[model samples]
Target: MDFPKLNLPPVALRTRMGDRGRTMVWDVLRRRYVTLTAEEWVRQHFVHYLLEACGYPAGLLANEMAVEVGGVRRRCDTVLFAREAARPRLIVEYKAPQVPITQEVFNQIQSYNSVLKVDYLIVSNGLQHYCCRMDYAAQQVTFLRGIPRFEELI
Candidate 1:
């Protein structure tokens, strides 16, 4: 796989070539090594950014959490929980750096958020990132300038 360098800040990673002849990166949230594909590369970068730069609480972040949508089971790429396991504070979906973040991507995240009803949503492709703040009362989503700090969320 041609892992392109994205616009996101660089973070040092622990990696190993897997037995299957693929590179793997350590997923701190999931506590395992996953094949370092294009999307996975972006995921690892953004997740690490959330932890090291944004100061997001590690305990609140999870990777590949089970979610039920449209009578089928799906796993969200990453989620930030508030004080409860069922309620997510933020839902994030990642794409490969080459994949453009389009309406379809936004709609996909929205669909996932339908069940989550999270306060915030993020869509990223490593090179670019978008965030929105949800107002259920107003039935509106306000685009944010950037990901809010953990303190700001609290």
Candidate 2:
């Protein structure tokens, strides 16, 4: 598959042929090879950015995390956990490079937040990125100018 160049910094990825010659890319967080779709390509790149560029610990990052919402199980794209508290601090959702980030995407992440209650939420389509800090007490959402470093989140 021909993957488009993303806005994120490029990183080396381990890839291999899977069943029926499908391309599989190694997921560091999941520790397995997952099929490399357009969205997966963006996800892998962003996860690498989070680890190598943003100072987030690998142990504190999770991919395809299960969450319970409205009596249903859903998978969050990426979740960052608090080191000391062991609670979710941030959540990230990814889309294909061609997909535009919209309010529906925000609503989807917000629904997941209902269960995780993370302080930060991020939405990316590889080419564009957005970060929001949720102030539950004030019932306000603050759009961040850029993605914050791991230390800043704490």
Candidate 3:
């Protein structure tokens, strides 16, 4: 299976054919092999971008993180945690390369934010990316010029 070229820096991923001719890729953050869907393809690229280009520590990044929202369990695509406090600092949502990044996409992340209450939010469709810094104190959302480095997040 050929994955679409993402806007993010190219990343090397370990992939293999799984049962029933399914494609699978190794998830370093999860320490397991997961089915390589289109969204997962974008997710893997974004995670590598944060690790290799943005200087985010692998230890602090969690994929498929579960959070309880409105009495239901929802899994966040990726979550960045503070090293010192081990608290969630950022949430990332991924979509297929063909899926347009729209306000509906942002609203999905925002719903997850209501539970995580993270300071940063990111949405990506492999072809395009968006990052926002939420200033709860000021009740404002600032769209960042670009994806921030690990230090900038702190």
Candidate 4:
């Protein structure tokens, strides 16, 4: 798969083809190798951008955390935690580079937000990125130019 340059910073990744030509990518955060699909490629790049370019501590990030949506268990792509550890500050949802970011995608993350109550939401497909600052108390959401730095959330 040809991975395109995204809005995020360049990332140096370690990837290899596995048995039956299954591509695998090294997950520095998880400290393991995972299947390298199109979406995963975007995810890895975003992770590196958060850690290297934006200064988000690896300890404060979680990948594929499980949540309940409409009584159905689902996994969120990534979440940035507040210092409290339990409180999530941001939720990131990623799609394959070729996938179009639609309202359904936003709705899916919003469902996760219904449970997380995060202050920020990001949806990306490597080709495009949408960042939103949520004012839950005011029942409003404002789109941003790009993802904010880790310190900005703090």
- Give Cα-based local distance difference scores for all models: 0.90, 0.95, 0.93, 0.90
The Cα RMSD in angstroms, rounded to one decimal, for candidate 1 relative to the true structure is 1.3
How many angstroms is residue 90 displaced in model 2 relative to the true structure, after the best TM-score fit? 0.4
TM-score of structure candidate 4: 0.94
In model 2, where do residues sit more than 4 Å from their true spots? none
The candidate maximizing TM-score is: 2
Clashing residue pairs in candidate 3, if any?
Answer: none
Residues 6-117, candidate 2, lDDT per residue (tens digit)? Answer: 9999989999999989999999999999999999999999999999999999999999999999999999999999998899999999999999999999999999999999
- Candidate 4: C-alpha lDDT: 0.90
- Number of backbone collisions per candidate: 0, 0, 0, 0
Writing each residue's lDDT as its tens digit, candidate 4 over 82-153 gives: 986678999999999889999999999999999999999999998798999999778899999888888887
Q: Supply the global lDDT for candidate 2.
A: 0.95
lDDT of model 1, residue 80: 95
Candidate 1 per-residue lDDT, tens place, 1-154, comes to 5677877788787899999898989999888999998899999999999998898988889999888999989989999998655579999999998899999999999989999989999999998999999999999989999888877874
Record all residue pairs in model 4 with backbone atoms less than 3 Å apart, i.e. clashing: none
Candidates sorted by TM-score, best first = 2, 3, 1, 4
For each candidate, C-alpha RMSD in Å?
A: 1.3, 0.7, 0.8, 1.3
Model 2 worst lDDT run, 10 consecutive residues: 145-154
Considering summed lDDT, which 10 consecutive residues are worst modelled in model 3?
1-10
TM-score of 2: 0.98
Q: Which stretches of candidate 4 lie over 4 Å from their true place?
A: none
- Mind sharing the TM-score for model 3? 0.97
